[model samples]
Target: MIDTATAPGSGGAPPAAPTRAGRRPATTSGPLRREYIWLALLLVGTGAAYLWNLTASGWANSFYAAAVQSGAKSWKAFFFGSSDWANAITVDKTPASLWPMELSARLFGFGSWTMLLPQVLLGVASVALLWAVVRRHFGANAGLLAGLALAVTPVAALMFRYNNPDALLVFLMIAAVWTMLRALDDGRWRWLVLCGLLVGFGFLAKQLQAGLVLPALALTYLFAGPPKLGKRIAQLFAAGAAMVAGAGWWVLVAQLWPASDRPYFGGSTNNSIIELTLGYNGLDRLGLGSGSGKPGGGGAPGGDPGGGVTAGVDLAAGGDMPQMHGGFHPFGGQAGITRLFNETVGGQIAWLIPAALILLVAAIILRGRAPRTDGKRAALLLLGGWGLVTGLVFSFMGGIFHEYYTVALAPALAGTIGAAGAVVWAERERRWVRAVLVLSVALTALTAFVLLSRTPDFVPWLRWLIVGVAVLAAAGLVLRGGRRLTIATLLAAVFVGLAAPTAYAVETLRQPHTGGIVKAGPATDSGFPGFPGGNRDAQSDPESGAAAPGGDAPGGATDAGGDADRERAGGGGPMGDEKPGDEVLALLEQDGSAYTWVAATISSNNAASYQLAADYPVMAIGGFGGGDPAPTLAQFQRDVTEGKIHYFIAGENHGPGGSSTSEGSKITAWVKDHYTATEVDGVTLYDLTATPKAG
Candidate 1:
């Protein structure tokens, strides 16, 4: 392969360097023009894929959607992560990721489109930004491939189209990557500062998850940056400081403020943002503590000896993934070495893992230990290290790992695949490069077939067709081929790598997902658990009264009578079953109150639905799980006596004999015993205003 920098010329000299002002010397503009066209297509295609039928799910996770809506209403709620503008308590995670959604809702008047539009735009922008970053170092083709690979990855499509923090997390991380690369190229301190700011802002999006790329990025710069060793260290230190300023300002402010002045941090035991960061969102995720780890049944960390709240057990964790039946855990079920490649998770994000691995290995061998300063070596380190390290973390992290969390792995995977493609394409004349490309496509196709086989209910023919095309594309590369045939072979390889995932993504779009965690795909049948789109007839389970895991009703609630009702109420809405029902709203309106809270409910989702529906503040009594003791029994009594709270919606709890037993059980029991139960819309409501004072 000819190096453009050293191509034959009168002196066989390297190309002239760019001026100090950073303008490049003029060259033939054809490649640049072609790149622009490819970029345009990539953006347009990504937008179309993400935006198509986007609102079909209608506020993907009511949990976050409610938070976004609340944020739009109150600046305090926006910053504190409250799901309601009551500003009583924060959501489990921080509010950094919700900022854009809040702004969108505020500007667009709060609807499904407003909730999700930012995610769509962010996803598209990330693709464009990734292209720019890759093209700067590896030329146009590699950039185009990287952008396309990221844009089409099924999980990427699913996450970007949904109202999840991951969309913004990914975008900010990409921006950080792009800026970091720029800093390396320009050897400028300002770029490093900007990189830090981006990463810090990313931290706001997802706490520690956003920082996973930091070590690799910082180390890469220290080794390969153009500055002297002393200067690089100093600059990296400055960048680290900038990162802390950007990401930690909120934590600092939240901590310094009097507890009475701000909402309680939802996920933390003592309402401390720092604890939330270091524990639930930090160390516990690494399986070192009690924070929510991967999908399995891991124990929560015990409390601090000083009487801080201890982490609780999460049953939903490894028992059986929600909504999945037939042992096909689309989201990982257990934390282990092979989690990512297993049948449960592979199809969603691992469509090209085999191909990327093969290409990475081949490229590493072909590059033959190039010097640190070599562009190829740096590119390999940046992309390959990011992919491998992240994949391993996601595979082994022992806490609350969700299927969508794997979207973090998408960009790195795409980058490595693109970098490998570029190296192989550059060496197309070599038999070994061609052979590696063939091996990559074959592995990708075979792996994709295996993943698709795990869900035979989805169209199986698509897998066979993808495999056949991939095989043919591999053959085309080995056969005597013209330039057009070579291009065809490349296209075939791209198609095979993308086709199966694309089909799965299409099915995901066709279906609807709700709840705190969701996956992309149609229900296999009416019996499929957690699937809101299952056939109505197949969903009924007479014994449990609740539909099975995958068999959730379209409204997101189960019809099961007792425990299921509690789950539905506790889980919050998009349950489709929840309706403000003119009756419920009218009843509340008729009974005016001096209290800021119009009513109280167990779960944040329940309160969120009522608040959004009624445009009133309803207390989410026990936080998200109905397990957090947000407001104590004593507090509720004081609020009642002082006229700070009115109605209390009773009967949502997890206890023996379907009785009330959760964090706020004392409150629930107190309300039940004092205020007479009035059934409205099949929910037991209590008129707190009617209760007699305790002597």
Candidate 2:
């Protein structure tokens, strides 16, 4: 939303009337009366999209779901994002995103509602916030359209309903944008400070990913904000300082805390939170660091045990096999410019990207030679820059990015479409603007058609129908039925733009995207192309007796971080078969006392399943990737001797960074060599209590 409301002595243009019938009502109260109705509709629609069948996925991404449960059980776990309430180690990513989920669990007790409800509410709030922000500067109609577009975006619906950090990240990023726009509206430094604070919280939500919009916000203020340069710079500095304080304090506290009192930083080789930030969460994600494809780089809590190196269990070891099919390319391709639009990712987030780009260029050109202070021009630049910067970063960054990461692009696309469409619609009476509308609708429909083609069998009829509607709508835009025809065509165009994503969203909701990077399309049994892991086939992990029914397994099926594996501990419903079955549970319960850890395993999902099944701490010894030095051989031996650990479950040896020589692997080897193995419920178990005590 763009406005020319000026502060005292600030040089700005007069506010343009809102586009067409979208004009502000005669009185402020009058506008609110009608606006509230649309806002309510937007909120309700978004809520339904996000909350419908919300628990079908059960504890979606049981990896993080376990963390949410842990955080609910203990304050220390809540702060550290510990997968088990025992606080042995932390999840790789920051815990800010999980705080709310944990709070919900604390209030409601652990269940699907605690796991998925926060995301649903956040999705609704995001829609409302988008409407308010767009309306403040654009108009009621434009704001409503923006909210609708965002609400229907396939990725938006998929992510807002899912329990990943991306949902909160998206919400915070949008909040930051709204705050910055408000700051620009009145040239208020306080608003700017608030924007910075929101962004800093965004950092806490997703680390460096949050800074993707800083460039756009900074540039907008520097080039287009009110009045003098010195004051502006000073105000920006204040904002920056506030941002540093908001984001840095947590890192500082994490670093300065006594190591003995805190869990080891999960992804950091050196056990430093700052190191984890700079390495795995920062440079590695950009493909600038060597750890790009390593465990924890994508900021997933329980990383792929082998770092997406290979899937399927190694029968000999009873865990993920470290067969070096390739150099840890989980999604299976080199990072490049075309990554987001490829087969694996295109259907998820790229469907509307081309339309957004076309609309942006058209908006800019339609405002040809407008004065620098023109509100429309300012709006175009602000939105264009925001979309371009975030989109480019995602496009070019060489990291272990998942398809679901496209959720970040949702707001940019929605904002661009809403604001640019308003500008174009406001000028639609112009022949050129009408032509632009026709072209925009055609491109949008065409792009959506191509994206839909990727999964031909999914609502196959809609493909031709959308193209036909788009063509007729364009013809109507050009025909002679006057404003009524034009309005119908515009509505048709909006319909065509939203239809594909709406269907995809419905499909997304209908299917249980329980694990791995969720790509929008009809749910398929095929695993990700070039995925080096197990085929998306429902099979039992021979060691765990954990059967994945129809490829939607419980604990191990997901990739971790974004789209995760569907494998749960139990076989059905929210909790799934998280328990270790009756036999294993009985054996473990026989000597449950005097042991700190219920079971030890290399897979985070494995441990998560056990933790959820038993509601007791199961140590994911080596962390998500089975690579982090959460427990070395010496530490394990010492713990066993001290009776801190009881059972050691054998599983995958491969860690994210390398081969089976990791701390967790060594401990497993030592345990295997010394202790007698017991096969309980398909899991190879080592009873530490059965070993003789060495004097």
Q: What TM-score do all the candidates reach, one by one? A: 0.86, 0.87
Expressed as tens digits, the lDDT of each residue in 1-695 for candidate 2 is: 22313211111222345443234435455545766876887798778767876765666666777788889998988987887887878878788989989999889888766678999998898888877666666666777778888888777878887777888888888888887776665577887899888888888887888888788888878776664788878888988998888788888888888887877777778788777778778776666766433433222334333333344433223243333222444552435677667766676777667777877887788666765445556666766787888777777665565767888888878888887777666666568767877888888888888878888888999989999999989898788376567567777888888899889888877655554444555654433431212223112221212223223234343312111221221111112123345576666566665567887776576677667766678787767656677776887788788888778776555333334556766776688678887766555678887855353
Tell me the tens digit of each residue's lDDT in model 1 across 453-537.
8888788798899988987898898893676787778788889988888888777766555544456554433222332221221
Q: Pick the candidate with the highest TM-score.
A: 2
Give me the runs in candidate 1 sitting further than 4 Å from their true place: 3-23, 27-30, 291-331, 368-371, 524-577, 589-594, 654-663, 693-695
Give me candidate 2's TM-score against the actual structure: 0.87
* Root-mean-square deviation of Cα positions for candidate 2 versus the true structure, in angstroms: 6.3
Error of 2 at 435 (Å): 2.0
lDDT of 1 at 241: 97
